[model samples]
Target: MDKRYVRAAVIALMLAGLTLHGGIASAQQKRDTIRIGFVTFLSGPAAGPFGVPARMAAEAVVEQLNAGKAPAPYDTKGFGGTPIELVVIDEAGGTTKQVSEFRNLVSRQNVDYVIGYISSGDCLAIAPVAEEMKKVTVLFDCGTPRVFEEASYKYVFRTRPHATMDAVAAALYLLEQKSGVKSYGGINQNYAWGQDSWHDFDLAMKTLKPDARVTTSQMPKFGSGQYGAEISALIQSGSEVIHSSLWGGDLEAFMMQSVPRGLFRKSQLVLVAGEPYLHRLGANMPDGTIVGARGTHGVFAPDSNLNTWLKTIYKAKAGHDPNYPAYVATLAFLGLKTAFEKAKLEQASSLKPSDDALIATFEGLSFDSPSGRATMSLGKGHQAVMGTAYGTTKLVNGKVTVTNVKHYPAERVTPPNGISSPDWIKGGMKPGK
Candidate 1:
């Protein structure tokens, strides 16, 4: 052969070698580990009381996934494969800090999916950003109704029940369970979580008991001490039942202060998100007080095999009873995994599986959570339609425990569409004089 022909042959062989190596690299990339951004209030007053439990749950779920433990019934992997590794971030600061950290996580760290957010304000702040960035954000604990009120984002999803759901459940339980309880009062923090919860609860009470009266409504600054004035006002209001959305340190302080002032003993007291306070308050909590987790309680100890297993694992890991926040993180991971697997199964030639596709799969998706079954709405708002647990607090084995747990379906409590919460409350349901 001529020299030119020999040179061409050598070049072709080198090109062929490059193509083979490239194929191997592409295969490796396909099997690359997935990265999930786990963000939450990891420091400050919220950490030990509420945020730390969430973080631990996230860590525990991730550990189980890596170990190939059976994912919850809602798991998308059909009970196989390791889940994506979580990239944790401390959202200890306020909303501004959360937005900055979220941007960094997505733009710089390049996380595949995001989970965690205990504060409703932080959730609302991050929702739009998550939409703009086109990342799948599973809000683990942000329950404020405003987060999904008017948003048209397809990527934002909440794995836990919304604030309205909690309020409605509380209202219904009061009406059905506590007959002859005529008047209602509220004491909530002034922020989004508190305001929304109070308004929603009011609406629910009005719907159930048209003559139910709201004697007093108070909003204290978030994390403020000295509830002396609020407690004095509540005592004077002559309300038979008082519902409060206070949590974290605020809750601890309120209970410590109010108990001594005889606020709870005066009448029926309902403490929303009360599970976190049980361990903190211990036997000091007032018995016969109505309290339950905001959306779900890990202490219910449902007879399901999954629940038993989770309780055992959680107890072994955390050395205490797991609260609702832990389940929030676990549910988030379950939601993402389900969505991703569904997207993969439904892959088409033109529409390959991507983050957007995974998000779309969340609609109408039902999964068995630590709390019973949870389903997502298909409309603009991707809120989880899950069950709520209700019960009165009791001292068991020298510990505060919420007993006589009754599961309430979400549909029965949530306000009907097109009605504002305030209007719903004011229309009727005045306490009988």
Candidate 2:
């Protein structure tokens, strides 16, 4: 009588063991998709030039990686089986909104990494949160030196060169190309990027041509539609050269306003972040205007292998030529790919890599970018060592293009260690006592 009941109980136990084993097997078989949080101004005046292309580039890169169609040096799948799953967040308007979004991404969404921030202020605001959360943040296009300088967060790493490098490159180009240019004026947006750009350009120009005076300085509130007041002030000051750091809608509006006012006729206009707007502005942009990307122009002119491939892929996906935003997006992913590959190697060797391992992998890691080779220095601050490209604007065949291109080495412009940009400028500007 007991044997029959015992056999039934043994069968039940066997079924339960199989069920538990199957559950564990299913969990092990599930593929882990790397989650990345991407933040940008997707709906605003700045969206068209900076945010739109950035989103497009991100999608394109992910798509290519999944499809197994991307090339080497930037090939995402080359880092083994870690496929990325991006969760995009639209940081509606300001730095405050960006900080809020960053907290949500880290605390709530629990993303593996973060990649996008076009505004300098937003990047600066979010750097602390990244450090607190212990997330790897690959900043795409925030160029203000203050982001890396004022806040020395170990988790923050920028792919683009700082504003000071952009300013130095532009200043050197203007003096080398333009003849009989003595006095210059600056018209920049009233923000950290603008302030730093003008200050650095002034310093560089003073060093290159000491007697070259900066006659007029104007910093209009960003996104201001009309630049007539600033343009008039510069004209009245009788300066022969003008430098501007306006970007996105701000730059577009400035170009539309200043071109017809005969400002270009009076002075040689130098507009940073100009290549991105070339297609949008086309013939409306003043010819012979000196303009380029902040640190490096992101286009295939004649000698860039990566730029050529990027241009083709970007145009095929978005139906437009790739700009600096595309370059930033690509660089962001490249940095991630590099770190993950290194992490994988460490994991294979029976080592448990920490978040700092990811950061250390990027330190001194160099890769060929669309513009040129970019490397990170994990010194006092995790800043990038990247080159820049500059050129003059011209409408050729109904398309805007930057001609007579010149590339500048990054080390030539980066300031020395322990020296803040503001302090360096102040020291350089001081008169002999």
Candidate 3:
């Protein structure tokens, strides 16, 4: 045999073996990996307070899941032995831009699961897109009740309670703590989340306390970063009680600007989603400011071994306590893990579970979170119902902390079956009574 011909034959064999090996590796990767697109406000005003911690929680949870070191029900080691690979996307632009980005994530990125959305407008925009594209998605933090109210979906579901719960919890807390507060005022971001929060809070007040009137309503643009005029309007309204659902940097700015203007001292303020700003505001946070996590979260509430573990891990990773955004994100990941495992168990095939399998598993599911139990409504458009916790803020040892905390079950605030929130209120069922 010629030396050149022999050498060429040897090289061809080597190349063939390498190609076979590569094909096997690719197949193994596909079977063992779960790709997730995790979207949150990585930039813009909501980044520092809300998105960053949530992202950190995502990183920590994924690391733990990959290592098979998480707590139970979540101890299954990464979605039933498959590793999680998360691609983080910044939710900065407007609703239209978000819709486009969502499409890109589903079609181009080819992610298995899509999670995270703090903006209500973004949530409303992306739900339909997820359904149209047949993408399985979990809206982790968006609280607008309008998502399910406006449309129905098979592949889209929110893993956290809706915005109406926060408002109802706040109103119930106010009436319980401050029965003398006959007049109230509201200042919320002028968007879907804010508008829905204000409306729900107002309706809750009317149903729970009929004598109480909303004297003034201020709808500041999202991320406006200024609330001096809105503060003045609130003050002039002579409201004995004030309500706000602002979160992230907007909430911080409002509190800072309002404190100097004596807004906090003048009226009792209730913040529907305020836990994110607690550490940032610290002593600057007004004493007696009634606030709630969108659900049971933050350092003061969610007193459990799971929450303790979460706080310890989150503080070690991000050098701070875990807040509502972080808690909700963690819960969302756990829910995903549960769904994937359940889907795997229910299916007959040994092959990897499909997106439809995951969706079916997620619908009408119940799982344990760090805070507590969370359930997805079986026939109610896949809406989630989680308990919420409220408390009063105080400067304790120069740190902002909540005390006198209370928990409201999901059924307390959630609208009845087949009834809108406004109609439920108009129907004269006083929540939390």
Candidate 4:
């Protein structure tokens, strides 16, 4: 009787072990595709110049990733061997609409991650929503410092530098090039992005060039192409250097109007964000115009394998050279790829990344980008910083090119930990200090 009972028990135990092993194997085999939501200005004032090229680059990169043809570190198949699916969303709608769209991407679309935003107001409005929704999000282009300064969020990050870096770099370029120019004039768009950029540039001017004075300032409405009145005032005020942070269609419109009106002939123009429009404006864009590309992006980027690969592919697909937006979009997507791979390694799982895992992996992470190495700060805040590039625009053989290009290290352009950008400038922080 004892022998028979032992045999029966052994058989039951063997069957239980087999069932458990099969369950675990099945769970491991069932891998879901990684879904991502990409939002950008696909159909608005920013569409033609900024968002369209960004979307084109996004599509090409996703395709390359899916094909397992991307560069090293991101060279593996789509998001750590799991195929990636992308959903594109337009960011033309105002702030309220963007908030709704971001929620929809998380709740309805069930996106594992979301990226892209060009409008600073949209970035500010959506950051809190992303936090409340507990969705992993990235802002590719918005530059307002308020995203992290005004409030903090665990689930959101910006893979590009803020507006302050752009302004600071612009001011440094101006002073380095034309130190004798003592008068500065501002003509930023009337919006969060424009206002913040103007403030930062003004502060930088005062900090670096204490003797310089702002002769006149204009807060033109965003998308308001009519700048005749503002141009008139700028000319009348006798400004030696006119600092502007306008971008996309607005930047293009200003360049077009000002060129015809001889505004460029009167004063030295410093455009904080002027790369994207260079392709469209070509020779019309005045030579020697000081321009900043937010970071070491686009035309100002140094030669590297990653930059060359992205530019080649993007140009082939879009039929034009990639711009600043494309570079930032690629950076954000590559950062996500890096984060997903890291999560997979930490969890020892081959499945798609979860929202929490993605966020944890991204915080304080560093990776290579077209612009150089980008670092997400964990000690200060979850903000990504990279080197900045600034230069003057020149027409070379019927093509727009940047001259006197300089790259400012992230430490120089980015503020120190626990200090807001404005305070950092007013406190007399200088590059390389």
Candidate 5:
């Protein structure tokens, strides 16, 4: 046989092997499971209230999706028939540790995507790394504006609105609910989320209600669990209203300590991250306390098919209603699912979509959630903007629940594209386009 003919035959055999089992084996070999790095706090102070709920939400959402029982628009089974495999990581240690875990997930575990990070610090540090590694990372509920406000990324996306909405809506809620709110003060954890929340709330107050004076401001070290000095200072300040963005154990500890000190009765308490604790804290929270669920989540979550489904399953397993953290985590997973199906369907193929395809399709994608409509309206269409809801807690029939719930539309609270939160707030916080 001629040398050329033998070489050509060998090439044909190799090509034929690539098409074995009608490309089924080849496809499976390429990618059988979609690995996702699901990062959230699983240990330490934040575990019980914040991280555990989020973890439960992830498990339920994944199980339902794999079972092909998720509500419409998200009814597709596990990223277009490819089962999802999650590598759950605890976001406990700090930003540095979280960053290291993220690289481990991407490089060692070989995750295709990442969806996690409840801390703003983690999100801020991970966003650039996500871009650098060219991986698709979805931020569930960090809320700080600094992530996208300072820089832009093609791979990093947030499925929920940032802290600006939470803080702005919080201030706007107070302005609408109260009269003669002439003075205010805050006791927030001294971290990115805390600092950002307090700053935005202060700025929004300054812009909305110019007369609202800052009687005092306190920044306690995170996880300190002791606010003796801060609470005493806030009580002495005699402010009409006291604001706090504390969440998880920190928020719980503050309420436990202050409620006994009669702080809530002395001054109106506005807990921006308080909706989850409404039931847990019960009458201890005091009636008329202002609360927000970050967005349209938890007690303020609207009635919908998606909401009912998630709530029923989550409550069954978690033994309590899914809170704001769970709701936000579900939103992130659903967003990823929506994006994956969109990218996959455009090809009309059974194979999973490419990272570039998913990224292209996800930008500016508007999708439904358990809460409501979420649009990729900010950060050059890379970040999400969702409506935020706030309400005052009322104890009725022995259960702590929100009354007088009011939702601020995404357009009203979220800054429009091409503008940062500070600029928008300074420019009068004009409604989004």
Candidate 6:
């Protein structure tokens, strides 16, 4: 009695299966946009300084690239005429959360690539995972030298020079600017980024001033917000100069806490990653303080067509000039764009290029950026090297201005390829002449 009913049910199931297959096939063939897994600290102490600016810059750059508004060499509409859609993820939680987030981005969301990580801890956690997954990942910020020195990954690359350059350039600037340079110490946040920065600076200072004593060194946890004890220790330790590579809200909080205690007034303060908060610090940034932007960023950025265009859009988005983090993020996008377009042009047959093809194009690739030209000349072309600049701050007409600026070449600051920063610094650090 149910023979006709059974046949009707079989036909209905077959039709449904066919419809699903057609839908899946259309999704695979008609997809014209590539999704990028963009991770940053959307909500955290680091958001205002590092994460927000980086996200803003990324949005601006991707929008311009999609519109074919980017300058020459990057004028192509997105990557090989394919639009880019960002699947933004917050990087506030610890490294474990970040690793989970990374997996979800790759496996669940199916992001074509990832461009993010403003923390060295996050980068370290994500790097091996990136290699394991064979997904292209670009690190925008996070200034630890250990990422490349400790290991190598084919799918991971950094667009910004590591923290070693920040400290090396800062030390060289200090020696050149001061006469005696008797004693110095540092206060760095307790993490890979902070530890690496302090280690490099300590070695550089020891190499440069053999007799100078280290009166005090403090390692505070990131976003501690209260540095009263550290400030008191540095002040009591009789250090003549204080060097700090702290960034984000931690850096700003240190200044706010240390200035009232007369720490900046009592001792020379060198803020290696302090250029971003120049406006927030304003007159509070302290005159005669040595400030560095990590690279040629902020007021230190050169006047170029790319710089002009980027600064205009970045300002409109960020409501202020682009800082080191913002510049580094945008540069990462530019580097990605340059490599993608170049790979596409070099091979017309491969419509969707393999990871190897893009990585091959990215290796040792040099590209024009808003700040200047960036070269992936270190870590066997897995890491980038860029010139760094340091300047003294001066309050003039109620605004903080960089005075007596000095620029150091990339060769002078960065360790050579195949040499770890510690080995390079400890072994007399031979630099290019």
Candidate 2, residue 422: the lDDT equals: 58
All candidates: CA RMSD (Å): 9.9, 9.5, 7.3, 11.6, 8.8, 5.6
lDDT (10s digit) by residue, model 3, range 1-433: 6899999999999999988775654455444578899999988877887888899999998998889888776877777877888989999998988888888676666677899798887988888888889988899988777788767888888888777778888888888898888899999999877888888888888878888887999999988998888999998998998888887778878888988888877799988877778878887788999988888877544567677778878989998788888988998998888888888987746544787887887888998878788888723638788778789988989988788888887788777556677787667654432
Error of 1 at 226 (Å): 1.4
Q: What is the C-alpha local distance difference test score of candidate 5?
A: 0.87
Q: Write the per-residue lDDT of candidate 6 for residues 340-395, one digit (tens) a residue.
A: 87888777675456788899989899999998989987877889989989999999
lDDT of 4 by residue, 1-433 (tens): 7899999999999999988775664445333788889999889778877788889999999998999988787789998888888999999979888988888787666777889788888888888888888888888888878788778888888888777788888888888899887898989998877788888889988988999898998999988988999999998988999989887778877888889888878799988888877778897889999888888888887788899889888988988789888999999999888988888887766476666777788888899987788888722447888878789988999998888988777887778667788889998865433
Error of 6 at 14 (Å): 26
Cα lDDT for residue 153, model 3? Answer: 88
lDDT of 5 by residue, 1-433 (tens): 6899999999999889766643553244455788888999899877788888999999999999988888787777888887898889999998889889888777666788999988777898999999989999999978788888899999999999887888888888998888579899999988877887888889989999887789998999989989999999999999899989898778888888999999877798899989888888886889999999889998889999999998998998888889989999999988888889889987766577888889898999999989888888688888898888899988898998788999888888888887889889988999855
Point out the higher-scoring one by TM-score: 2 or 4: 4
Please give the distance, in angstroms, between residue 76's alpha carbon in candidate 4 and its true position after superposition: 0.2
> TM-score for every candidate vs. truth?
0.84, 0.86, 0.88, 0.89, 0.91, 0.91
Ranking according to TM-score, highest score first: 6, 5, 4, 3, 2, 1
What is residue 11's positional error in candidate 4, in angstroms?
61
Give candidate 1 misplaced runs (Cα > 4 Å). Answer: 1-31, 71-83, 346-352, 416-433
Better candidate by lDDT, 1 or 5: 5
Cα deviation at 206, candidate 1, in Å, is: 3.2
Lowest lDDT 10-residue stretch of candidate 5: 21-30
Candidate 4 stretches with Cα past 4 Å from truth are: 1-31, 378-381, 430-433
Candidate 2 has what TM-score?
Answer: 0.86
TM-score of 6: 0.91
Candidate 1, clashing residue pairs? Answer: 210-429, 211-430, 212-429, 212-430, 212-431, 213-430, 213-431
Off by over 4 Å in 6: 1-30, 349-351
**Model 5 ranges with Cα > 4 A deviation:** 1-29
Instruction: Give every collision pair in model 5.
Output: 143-163
